[model samples]
Target: MKRHAVPAGAMLAFFLTLTGWPQCASAATPDGAALSALWGLPFAGVLLSIAVFPLIAPAFWHHHFGKVAAAWALAFLVPFAFFFGANVAFGTLVHALLEEYVPFIVLLTALYTVAGGICVRGNLQGTPRLNTGILALGTLIASIMGTTGAAMLLIRPLLRANGNRQHVVHVVVFFIFLVANAGGSLSPLGDPPLFLGFLQGVSFFWTTVHLALPMLFVCVVLLGGFYALDSYYFYRREEARSRFVESTPDSASFGIDGTVNFVLLAAVIALVLMSGLWKPGVEFDVFGTHVALQNVVRDVALIAVTLLSLVLTPRAARAGNDFNWAPIEEVAKLFAGIFVTIAPVIVILRAGEGGAFAGIVHLVNTPSGEPHDAMYFWATGLLSSFLDNAPTYLVFFNLAGGEAQKLMTTGATTLAAISAGAVFMGANSYIGNAPNFMVKAIAESRGVRMPSFFAYLGWSSAVLLPLFVVTGWLFF
Candidate 1:
């Protein structure tokens, strides 16, 4: 893949905006109530570009996606700076970058770098049982190593196992549904949204205790469905071939290279936990955004961890995994636009009952002023399918009365719905979660004909939407 160069003019303008104004003395943030719905168009534009461009013009999109993302970002920022003062615009940009985007890309970098180093060695048949087993195992570890980590660690092996098979798209689709999204519901360490919840005072084990039943239901249904579907295709292919023989020796034992990465993975998890647990109350204000000491430590430590993995892991291991920086670079650039354009949308949602989208706020409340659990689930979910789930989760978290203790107790069901929705429904679209896109990119790079964006949406709507309905009926 060719790297897109950042234009000199854009870089100059961005820096000028950043240093154009002094920091405000007060901590007052941007008021969503003052903004118009038109502020959200840039966000919609970027999303539309992501959805439509690759399908219509593959070569152009492949070569220029980063530039396109930057263009959309500037579209929002320029107007924002004009309408709202440069001070507000610059502060918002800094907050989005320092507080949200930086940490997000850092953690993803650590997971991707470390996981890419640990190559699974051995060849196996792509039998129905074997493929299903890999999915199950990946799902199991997703919460521990994060959905990104587990997906990076296992996807290559799964693809190689099915290299000789036709009708393998469903395998990768189910992998995204299970391993990349649904599997990370149990722990804050598992998903970005949940980790944000943890940082907001929700206990580490709260998701484990509350979301267990819902996660199990989705996993069991998806796993069973995958087995049956894979079996049907497997037999069909076998009938066509007349005989399906193992391509590699049965005696070739399975093992893992780059075992040191496992320790690095654990260190990544610990650094996350440490940031959440060890609050020194020391913070530096960078352009009006509060940068905490512990968070800075954690981000720095994670960077070191990523560099160590690159140094310690053998070059052969990464080559065997076909690891390249393209996926991470694509994620970083695209999500930078997402994180920026999404600011006004989040603020509007946060303005509940007084902001531009008060209708949405009303939908989640009943006539008696009580919380509607079902609406919370669907609203959080549908938006999460398109927006970044972490901020989407935070939006509903505040809407549900932002008290962690109360949310964990009296508002427990509402919290679960929001959490489950943000985590699980991320599978509803390719861009719903970071790992979903990475997994798709990796599979396609390996020659798997993954579904198109809308086609994948059709799959999720047909398969996952029904399951979600049943879950709402039974649990919510």
Candidate 2:
């Protein structure tokens, strides 16, 4: 793609191009109403999802079009606005200046293609009481496969594995916690926020060591708690399974066809890191002019990886394995819907409570005057469950890194809250994280209906919320 210029005049003009411009005037975003302006795109996306998905999906989904649409719209609309905006030279380049990490992540995770790479299925004749085991397995996949891939690949089986229960909503809620968001905390490949850190001078190793502990702690608690719920539900479903004792779980297995794809994904990570670690603040101008080299390189890498993956991954393997473009298609369509619908509200927020809305970020205070590293670990996480975790994480991540103070908070604590919050609480609602929608889709295709968006959040408030608070207290 050719490069474009961001004239000095366009900076102000760009702000004016936005629909609502006053809400975030006093915010710490440093971008005036820029981020506030883009909020409308995702809101538009929500409306589009409702209008379209119902018209297209088969009769099987008639009962759930409403819940599914709400969830899908939330998933796509949030990220869509960011990614769609990033494609612009001015938008991405300017955004990078905030911390220089977010655009790095946006370019690297392209996320579109990663949605198809991982999955798991249960063997026939197996008792689904093994659901707890599967959830643990899904957690590992979240780090390795990326949440989109892991969720798309494993969600069906998880629903089926837990098929016999009545109170399965709690099970799905914990799945969102451990499988969708918390499990994805360790690697940039795991969740978008951490991926931003990777693109910023943050080390992958540091993330695993520092960030992994808190996420693991939360996952463990949820797994333990969910397993109890799963057990109770299993009692309800025993009769159902007994009636179908001949029930053979459709068998499922895992393999990448070649280890090359994993290696390539690693290469993408390396290239993204190199821009941050070695090149530090370079953006590719493409033309003779000097712009940030990393921006160009990151986007180029994303496009290249996406195309090459499509070409090299063998079409037959994808088809024979039941891999299809439908999932990604759904993301694109639903996100488009979100982008259009949410455009207005984003402007309103920018014009309204935009400034004070930043109360979300707070550095932890410890008596020793050292960083309370676990703060982001818990805070970003807790809010991520309720708020749009991506921006919520960013709001806090940005806040945490304020000028060094004599106070107990420090950079370490700031980073912790950013990482923890971004990854942990994103599981709080079906709308909390992206993979949540995919899991819902996969489950619906399998005839297992997920809870409504608000209903799922209710489950989160009841189960995962208390569990997260405890984990947050213990760890952060």
Question: RMSD (Cα, Å) of candidate 2?
Answer: 8.4
lDDT of 2 by residue, 341-453 (tens): 33333333333224333333223435543445566566666655644455455445444443223111346645766677677777776556666766666666656666776
Off by over 4 Å in 2: 1-129, 159-171, 244-260, 285-291, 314-317, 320-379, 402-409
Best by lDDT: 1
Error of 1 at 14 (Å): 19
- Model-by-model lDDT, in order? 0.86, 0.55
What is the Å distance of residue 216 in model 1 from its true position?
A: 0.8
Encode model 1's per-residue lDDT on 34-114: one tens digit a residue: 878888898888888877888899899999999999999999989887777766787788888887789888998999999
What TM-score, over all chains together, does every model reach? 0.92, 0.66
User: What lDDT score goes with residue 72 in model 1?
Assistant: 91
Q: Which clashing pairs does model 1 show?
A: none
